[model samples]
Target: MQVVIEKRGASLKVKDGQLIIKHGDQVQALAFNTIDSIVLSKATVLTAEVVAQAVEHQIDLLFVARGGKPFARLWSPYFGSIATIRRHQLLFSRSPEAVAWMKNVLTRKMENQQALLYALAMPNHATDKIIESAVLKIEEDKQRLQQIEGAKLADLSPRLRAVEGQATRRYFQAVNIHLPEMYRFGQRSRRPALDMTNAMLNYAYGMLYGRMESALIKAGLDPMIGFMHREEYNRPVLTYDCIELFRTWADWVVFDLCRQQVIFREFFEVEAGGYWLAHPAKRILIQHLTDFFEDQIEWEGLTRSRYTHMSLFAQRLAALLKEYKTDKNKK
Candidate 1:
C-alpha cells in the first residue's frame, strides 16, 4: 500500500517509527514497513524527518503536478541492485544493441495500438469508423519503421520518432471520438491540459509513470540513463523510453472508461488549467486501473497479470543489456 497525502497544509514526519500525518484537525499514523511509497499531492508540506525515514525504510517519495502528472521523486542514494548494471546501462545507451532493442519496443507499441483499434471495431454494436482508420494509419507507420535500417542511435532516433508521431496523432483522433462531447479534447494537450480528456489522460499517465519508476528501481536499473531519448537534467529518461512500450495499455484503460460510461462530464470541474477530476472521480479511475492491472493477459505463451508482466519485462530488459555488454567485452 502507498501513503498519499493530498490535503493542503498537511504536515508529514516520522514519529516513533510511524508516518505521522497532521492536516487541519485530523491526524493519522501509518507503519513504515507496510508502506511501499509516499505520494504527496499538490500543496502538501513534508518535513525533513519524513525524508530521513523514507531513505531508511527504502521508500520512494513522489511529488506530482497539481492534477497528478509526474513531476519529481526522491529516494535512497544507495540502490538495491549492483553497480555493474548501471555501468552497463551507460555503455548500452549508444550501442547497436540499443537500436535493436528499440526495434522490438516500437514494433510492440504499434502492434498493440492496431490491435486495440481492431478489437474495438469488430462488434456490430462497437463498430467505430474512426478506430478502423486509425488502425490503418498505425499499420502504415509500422511499415515505415521496418524500412528504417541504421543501427546507430544518431541515425535511427529521429526516423523512429517521426513515424511514431504520425501514428500517435491518428490514435488520439480515434480515441477522441469515443469520449462524450463534453469530455472530448480533440487533440492531446499537456503541461496544463486544454480540455477534460487531456487532463484525465495526463493524470492516468502520471499514475503509470509512478509505477514504471518503481519497477525500474526494483529491477536494479538506473532510470535516468536511456537510449532513443536524450538525457535531460533530472528527467527519468529511461522511464520515458520504457513507457512507450506500455503506453497502449494506459490508453486502453482511459478509453475503456469512457466506453463503459464510467467517466461522465459531471465528474470534472473547470479550473484555471482547463479541467480536472473531482476528488472522488479521480479515486474511482485509480481503483478501476488497480483492477485492470491485476487482470490476466496472455504474454510470451503464458497468462499473467499486467502488473507482473511489467516487472518481468524490466528484468528481461536488464538481462538483455547484460548480454550485450558481455558480447561487447569479448569482441
Candidate 2:
C-alpha cells in the first residue's frame, strides 16, 4: 500500500525499522516492511534517516506539490538488475531509435484511448457517435505514424506531437459529450486546472508518474535520460516518456470514478478562479488512485497488477535498449 503523509507541517522519520510520523498532538509508527511507497505532499517534513531507511528497504519516496504533481523522487542508487542498461539508455536517447521509441509509446496511448472511448460508448448509444468519430481519427494518426519511417528526426517529432494533440482533443470532446452540463469541460487544463475533470486527471497522472519513476529506477534506467521528453531542469524525463503509454489508463480511471459517482460536483471547492479538491476530497481521491494502480489487468496472456505491468514494461525497455546497442555495434 502507498503511505501518504498529507498533514500540514507533519514530520516523518525512521527509527528501529519503523517509520515514525508526528503531527501536533498525534504520532504514528509504521513498520518499514508494510510500506511500498511513501508520498510526502506539501509542507511535510521528511527526515534524512527516512531517506536512508527507504533506500535500504528499496522503498520509493516521492515529493508532490499541493497541486498533486510529483516534482522529485528518491530511491536506492544501487542497481537492482543490469547496471549497464543505464549507460545504454543515454546512447539510445541520441539515436533515431529515440523517435521510434516515442512513436511506439504514443501509438499505444492512442490505441488505449480509442479502446477506452469505444468501450464507454458501448451499452449507451448516447456517446456512440461522437466517440466512434474520435476512434476513427486515431486510426488516421496510426497510419501517419507508419509514414514517418524514413523521415528526419526533426520532421518526425512535430508530426508525432500533432497527431497526439489532435487525438487527445477529439477524445476529450467525445467523452465530455456524455457528461452533464455542470460536469463538462472545454479541454485538458494543467497546474491550476480550470475545471473539475481535468483536476482529477492531472492528479491521477501525477501520482502515476511517481510510480513510473520508481519502476524505471528499479529496472536500472536513469529517469533523467529519456527518449521522447526533453531533459528539462529537474524534470523526470524518462517518467514523462513512459507516462504517454498510461495517460489513457488514468483517464479511464477518472471516467470510472465519475460513473460510480465517486467524484461529484459537490466534492469540488470553488475558490478564486477555478475548482480544486479540498484536503478531505483529495484524500478520498488518493485512496481511489492507490487502489486503481494495484488493480489487476490482463497483459499479454496473463493477468497482473497495474504496478507489475509498468515494472515489467520498464524491464523490457532496458533489455530492448541493450539489444539495440549490440546489434548497432555489430553492424
User: Which of the numbered candidates is closest to the native, going by highest lDDT?
Assistant: 2
TM-score top scorer: 2
Candidate 2: what lDDT? Answer: 0.79
The sequence of per-residue lDDT tens digits that candidate 2 reaches over residues 224-327 is 88665653656788888898898777777777776666666677777676677777668778877778878998976669988788889988898887676634
lDDT per residue as tens, model 1, 283-304:
7777777688778999887799
Residue 293, model 2: lDDT of 75
What is the lDDT for 274 in model 1?
A: 77
Q: Give the 10-residue window scoring lowest on summed lDDT in candidate 1.
A: 118-127
Model 1 earns a TM-score of: 0.86
Off by over 4 Å in 2: 22-28, 79-83, 122-124, 151-155, 231-234, 264-266, 269-271, 326-328
Residue-level error in angstroms, candidate 2, position 58 = 1.5
